[model samples]
Target: MQNMGGIFGILGVGCGLYIFYALYKLKSTGDITSSILLPKDVNPKTCKDKDGYIKAVAPKMAILGISTIIYGLMDLCETFVMSTGNFFWIVLVLVFVVLIWFSVTVSKLNKTYF
Candidate 1:
């Protein structure tokens, strides 16, 4: 109905703002506050340190981006799919838990190194 347009607008703005904030923090704090939390898909050798440690930022950002999109997708799906009981709640919880864990783990690991 009329609310769908408003909801779409809000989600678009929210996604844009989240990206803007993350990018700004990356520049100002030198820390990517948000990254994709995903299993690496590349060759292990490609991701490494001097000792060949498998670590990278792209994957994290990709995961984060995917998660954000999923949240919106699921939110919309709820209206059509009665099986998806209140997607917003699940998405909200997942977002908070995943982001908190990801941010903390990344920051702690960073401190241990440089």
Candidate 2:
């Protein structure tokens, strides 16, 4: 179980870094028309200012990615040092909360931007 936490931490960090890199590339190129980050059916050309739209959304993606990395670190710490039963429940609850928050954020982004 503890090993799982470490694995998740590594995976989360890797995913977060990848997201950051992708967003950075999008920002640098000022091209929002065709990006892996956007939804499949979303046409960036529909937006009035594609560059501005990308610029606005990139920060949100960065924040989400950073939060994921932080959650992974917290999970790793909980696994190593807080394995008591009560602490376990607390961590589980925290995980659920994070999941819900992340889902809501993504949904909102989709609704607002995509």
List per-prediction Cα lDDT, in the order shown: 0.51, 0.64
| lDDT value for model 1 | 0.51
- List model 2 lDDT by residue over 1-114, tens digit each: 775757876776676677678777768876652443556787765666666567666776676667666656666666676645665456456655755765576556556765
Model 1 compared with the native: what TM-score? Answer: 0.46
Candidate 2, superposed: residue stretches over 4 Å from native: 3-5, 33-36, 43-47, 80-114
Pairs of residues at least 3 apart in sequence or in different chains that clash in candidate 2: none
Model 2 lDDT, residue 72, Cα: 65
Candidate 1 clash figure, as a count? 7
User: Which regions in candidate 1 have their CA more than 4 angstroms from the true location?
Assistant: 1-54, 78-83
How many steric clashes between backbone atoms does each model show? 7, 0
Looking at candidate 1, the ten consecutive residues that score lowest on lDDT are 45-54
lDDT of predicted model 2:
0.64
lDDT score of residue 12 within candidate 1: 36
Q: Give per-residue lDDT, candidate 1, residue 6.
A: 39
